[model samples]
Target: MLRRRRKFLEEGYNCALCQDGVEETIEHLFFSCSTSSCRWLVLGIFWNDGGNIFDKLSTAKQAFPFPFFMEVVMIGPWCIWKERNALTFNGKAPNLATWKNDFKKEVRGHLCRIKSSLHDSINFWLDAL
Candidate 1:
């Protein structure tokens, strides 16, 4: 069984997203947490066995001709962090439906902001979704 940490809070620290009885550390938040793991699996569906998301993002400018990869890298962590904060501060629960809807909106917004024509990029994003 996972031992709960009681370092900072008056009560024990529980993961706001997964509630899997692990302390909320950076490692847990981004990779080990069940919630994050699920998100990563779903993201993998889009990325298609691209190793790590951060690895791909770091090479975006060199490997990818378009800015879509950068947008995905930027948005994925931001959305996860946002969800964590919402759960921590607002007592909100994890809702994949809302998360996915927001992701689509953010992706659409990012695609629209690209200055060049994105015919193929748009199709790629649509297919990925």
Candidate 2:
């Protein structure tokens, strides 16, 4: 997280949706903040609400397993940045649900492509099945 924040800040940006102010906050980038079009209700703030969310994202396991967590941690920020660019460069502002769906699918696809596996061989086989 620290690593990512430094990198993004060096690159320059706030959260794409709100554009109010975002300082490399993982929760804001991935979960919180309302979109440009709609003024009510944030995108995925339901999953927000943690101080060191990047840390949580990096090492979470209650719901998503490690590989899935890593996928989100890695891809969520890129999605946000891409959305921001799309809006600024291409004049496209996607809906909240669209962003959320994209996030989920991206994470899932990333995990699949990375060929993530569970701890045990049997578990991996079962998951593959």
Candidate 3:
């Protein structure tokens, strides 16, 4: 991948978080990086067992608290990617605690925007957090 070639070009290539021996491929970035993996592990308590985030999300659609579940699935990686970009482009570091708090706030904001009855969903989401 082009991203893996950044090192050959003298551009940034290694992961911003771990700086381990591997190139920053999508798989390593999203699934294998120490930082991202830790984040995913935290969220995994709520996620159904599957191969990865997308796989778990696809299987989660049938479960109740649909909106809450969907928001977590959609937003968790989004926030991680946003932080990854910040670190890549701005030399910023990943903040796991901040990311977790921000994720909760994002989920709550999304739930508020929807009109569905969320009594059970809210309780579930809060318990997961």
How many residue pairs clash per model? 0, 0, 0
Measured on C-alpha atoms, candidate 1 has an lDDT of 0.62
TM-score of each: 0.62, 0.46, 0.64
Please give the TM-score that candidate 2 achieves against the real structure: 0.46
Model 3 residue 102 CA deviation in Å: 1.5
In terms of TM-score, how similar is model 1 to the real structure? 0.62
Clashing pairs in 1: none
Better model by TM-score: candidate 1 vs candidate 3? 3
For model 3, how does the per-residue alpha-carbon lDDT over 1-129 read when each residue is reduced to its tens digit? 344345434644666667776788876776667888787767753345447767655665555434555555667778788887766656566898877887777766677565568756665765676
- By TM-score, rank the candidates, best first: 3, 1, 2
User: 46-108, model 2: which lDDT tens digit per residue?
Assistant: 243564766554334354433434444466567666776666556566566666666656655
Please give the RMSD to the true structure for each candidate, in Å.
6.3, 9.6, 5.6
Candidate 1's C-alpha runs over 4 A off are 1-14, 45-67, 112-128
- Write out the backbone clash pairs for model 2: none
How good is model 3 by TM-score?
0.64
Collision pairs in model 3: none
* lDDT of each residue in 1-129, candidate 1, tens digit only: 112222224445666688777888766777667787676555552332355656544544365444455566567667788887776666667787677667667666676666457646655764675
Q: Quantify how close model 2 is to the true structure by its C-alpha RMSD in Å.
A: 9.6
